[model samples]
Target: MATEDDGVHTICPYCGVGCGLKLKPGEEDGDVSLQPWFDAPVNEGALCIKGGASPQVVNHEDRLTEPLIGDGDGEFRTATWDEALTLIVDELERLAETYGPGATGFFASSKVMNEENYLLQKLARRYGTNNVDNCTRMCHASTVYTLRQSLGAGAMTNSMADLEEHGEVFWVQGANPAEQHVIAHSNYFREATRDGATLIQVDPHANKTTRDADIHLQLEPGTDIPLLNVVLKTIINEELYDETFIEERTTGFDHLEATLEGFDMEEAAERCGVPLADIQEAARIYAEADNAAIFTGMGMSQHTCGVDNVQNEVNLALLTGNLGRPGTGVNPLRGQNNVQGTCDVGAMPNVLPGYLEVDDDEARESVEEVWGFDIPPEPGLTNVEVSNAIGDAIHGLYVMGENPVMSEPDALEVENRLNDLEFLVVQDIFMTETAEFADVVLPATSWAERGGTVTNTDRRVQRMRKVTDVPGNTRHDLEILCEVGTRLFGDGFDFDGPEDVFEELRDVCPIYHGMTYESIGYEGIQWPCYEEGDEGDQYLYQETFDTDDGLGVIRGVRHQDPKEVPDDEFPLVLTTARLEEHYNTGTMSTRSPTLRRKTPENFVDIHPADAEKRGIEDEDYVTLRSRRGEIVLEAHVTEDIKEGVVWTTPHFSDARANTLTNDVLDPLAKIPEYKAAAAEVEPV
Candidate 1:
């Protein structure tokens, strides 16, 4: 299957590369192609494997056109929109009557629009419960939590444009952005490396990003804190600390210096599986650099100690005075299109719009005034907690866009919980694996068929036009959300369109003051957007932070190991990640034949030696068993992974990698351990 036209100008739907793509419309009927954007701000002319085949998804046949309802016989049946909505409303009312608001939870999707995500959170809060969460919880919730705690801001400090001008080192850890955020990495690494910026990669896997690195430290998993601590100790011992910046901008040098005293190179070397020489070299190079930057992905923040891992990174940056400057701050390469926006608009259970806490009386009062309703004061359970509580107590769940059955850890348990639920309503563009268990499925429009705004990784809100019509009877997600909200609660939600929602959001969310649909026209406006003559700061904390004392506080952190460790029986550490061809859960990417053909099924990415020792060969069907469960897939033996570690992408339900992931979550972020788990791999 090939495409009809050469391409249409569009944005990449995969990573934060946000590459400009030329989408080739189907020529013969059901094919599409994509090419590089010659004039993109980020990617001038390039595409990753994900972006290269992004156009194929819009023309995918498996995209759902009709609503689906799970009949009593463990099978889904096509149903009209009205019928499905009616059934869901009836069941929701029943659940509301039987159990209180706590029994009902809502899980919004990151892959949707900012307006829809905002509305979903509004519905949850207005409905008198905080049982709301999103995909951010699984990815960068730890990064967000740690940044908010330490810096009083929960976003990337510098824009990707900062990667253009650099004179220092680029320290990339916990992510393979070269393959993931292809365009950004190409510019920063491939293009900028020629200009003299040293690249340092830190990860267990010898990924694409590591291959071309000036220095690649293959550290052990869950050793982020120890390694960072060792670096900090080296910097302190060798007088590499930024004295002036620490004296003026920061407040916790004495305590931090004292804390780093006990952590030596020998202890850290053994703990982190990095040589003392390499640790010292990395530290010296970073300290000596004119403008060093730290870029992190989910690898650093998807563990039981996820918050600590990120805090350590931030601590490292702040110690070296890498704040409130250009090309010198913590830059989190966000996992999804509006992960930053969703958090900005209050998708998390604990926070309101503009990262305001629900427990804060002032913030609660502000939202209450705008909505004209008394909002709840208590914080809510996270996504993982809601999943664990599904069968235990929760009666109904309204899932929008996300396919948790294929993505959540201990997925078999998640399926059982969904099966046990009194009612499960899923709203998505396709009949996803999670939707297969839904009592009612609402067909929603995709990115191409919807008109709204999405916040990019840099907090730059971009306009997404309705380039294509709704595939069938599928409606915009916001409309469905409003309809369901009106049916459930009364007159709280009365928005006409995405703009109306944005106006309301800006009114209540203080950081968005003076921001309007008109102001944010065509080119997006970053938040902290104020009126003319009231400049909006790009990097925060220039004058002071948003804390009670107007100063950022350094929360003490302790190094903790992962809950699941490699043992004799389960000798290999198995981690799950996304591929360039497929996104999370693969509800859209996998539907595309071209994308599907690139990587048809899930496979175990094992080291060559490990495969040989186990009598396994490339493309051999192998069974990877963890304490939670087991999954059989084809083995992809390569040197990309370490000897005792294996990797798999969690995009396929036929071979879900999450089924074998440990459900242990970070105590602070409540995010599950998707990166590291103990598993045994053998030929199936």
Candidate 2:
């Protein structure tokens, strides 16, 4: 909502910390300025570097002010909205009419509001296709899979505020909150640590979070399952397991016990490249803490064994009575602003709105009754699967605010696959790398020029107010989608605006049913608010799990090697992560002068020992290669990384980390193994 004097309240469009700020028009149109929202919820007026400089991109020199139509050969011409919309509608209709609904795929964006993504998925379904997905598949799909199976929900079990208030120990694995989530670390986690909460960090690279950790376990990449198994073995051997809680609130303990019956913890620690004694010490501290929380990240989720890696974390939490409490449970540090909400609103291939299974007859019928159409019973392709099917099953693509060209693993192949598409349409504020390949591009309004709601990392559904007028001829994402859907089907797309679309979304999404613009005032409401006046839950499963039997399911998982292991040809492990100043794929962050000045280009981090072995010096331009692709970038020889592990970020297009990353996916969640890949390096 707008403040008293021409300022509007909105959430930062960067990370999931959801810092609140106010925006006002400048001396001219398309210019914006930031004002601290002192009474805003979450960050309480705190603005990270990215949040403070977010307005820079609103008036970026590269903003797409009008629609454009390209001739499929790196050439484009300005076009009216009517001409662009008609071209898109005719192409989409022709594709489906000639091939099938399966011939098309939709990519929703985590940077967009929950309401916009909800409408996009609805349009895809109404057009008779289930091939829709978002960036969550690239980051936290495995975490969601394991959590929903074991503990029932697919999000953070406890909010940041509750974790700071009651948590005694913080077991952070595979995540760096200090860099990725600045406000969350500075305001909540750092304060919690200062107040006596023990911080245990487990990662292959020593990041900013490692500096603040009481214990840092720098293990080898792709060894999360083994490391966690060693910890579980230590907990069970010491008789520190919560016997009463396990017997009363959980099941399948025998399965977990039998799997580790003849376990060799020393061997597990050796595989993890850590000492057995240190694992035991960390396990004891975690098991003995009155309240402990586990933070999982891409390190745990972006592997071929991603599902198994996270399930072991669940086994640890359940074995030590960490579930069903205010300060405990396995939490995923979401990478994007609305990643949690994107999945919550059902912008995925296999689920309907509110995570309802598309194949479930009863649930599918309920949604069909509301939309006046029948949804396909079988699930469709995920993001990577859709990419693989570009020349075959998928002939057309519709991308909204997502850049798969830079974000996808083995991006060179994804870049090539775009050329094989019969049609490609991109709706975004700026012309991203992916948008350059589009047959038609729809110019959309910036975040400060749109009004909607976004769900934060902790499940709070907060509202974003429109603070400025849209630029030349640019329309809202919702408006562009409505025009396309109405132009094609001519029904179920007559919504006036985002607020009108949200009302229909509430009827289908049960978790967001109890919320409204008025009810979700300055302080947003958390999900699972089933009815009006409900305060919502700060932590889930206080008494019983959400599983069918009302008991948390305990399972056992063993270590599995990465899809590609370093051999003689490629004798080094390549790990990838993002920096504090950048967001995924460098769409909006690279345009910000503040963020670009801090991190102007991409670079690789190589340990001094490894650099010396290759006769390489610091700041040398290095050519890094994998079996798939190669990129040349500068190097930093430091002790921050392990001896055989080279780390890099995926923010720059010239040296995109995804170009050399493996495309092998986890079996269940289908997430690419971005954390570990067999690679080689040499002087450029």
The global C-alpha lDDT for each of the candidates, from Candidate 1 onward, is: 0.79, 0.91
- Where does model 2 exceed 4 Å of error? none
User: What lDDT score is found at residue 447 in candidate 1?
Assistant: 72
Which residue pairs in candidate 1 have backbone atoms (N, alpha carbon, C) closer than 3 angstroms, thus clashing?
3-27, 3-31, 4-26, 4-27, 7-23, 7-24, 8-23
lDDT of 2 by residue, 1-684 (tens): 435485778899998878889888888788888889987878988888899999999888898999999999978899999999999999998999999988999999999998899999999998898999999999999998888888888888889889989988999999999999989888888999999999999999999999889999999998988888888888888899999999999998999889888989888899989999998899999999999999888889999999999999899999999977878989889888899889988899989888888999998998898889889888889999999999988899999999999999999999999999999999998888999999999999989889898888888889888878888999999988888888989899899888888888888888888888888888999888878788888999999998889899888888889999999989999999889998888889998988999999999999998899898999999999899888999999999999899999999998999999999999999999999999988998
Candidate 2 least-lDDT 10 residues: 1-10
* Total clashes in model 2, counting residue pairs 3 or more apart in sequence or in different chains: 0
lDDT (Cα, tens digit) per residue for candidate 1, span 9-109: 55566665555555544444334455555665456667776666666667567677888888845688889888887887788788877897789899987
Q: Cα lDDT for residue 273, model 1? A: 80
Give one clash count per candidate, in the order shown.
Answer: 7, 0
CA displacement after TM-score superposition, residue 509 of candidate 1 (Å): 2.0
Write down the RMSD of candidate 1 (Cα, Å): 3.2
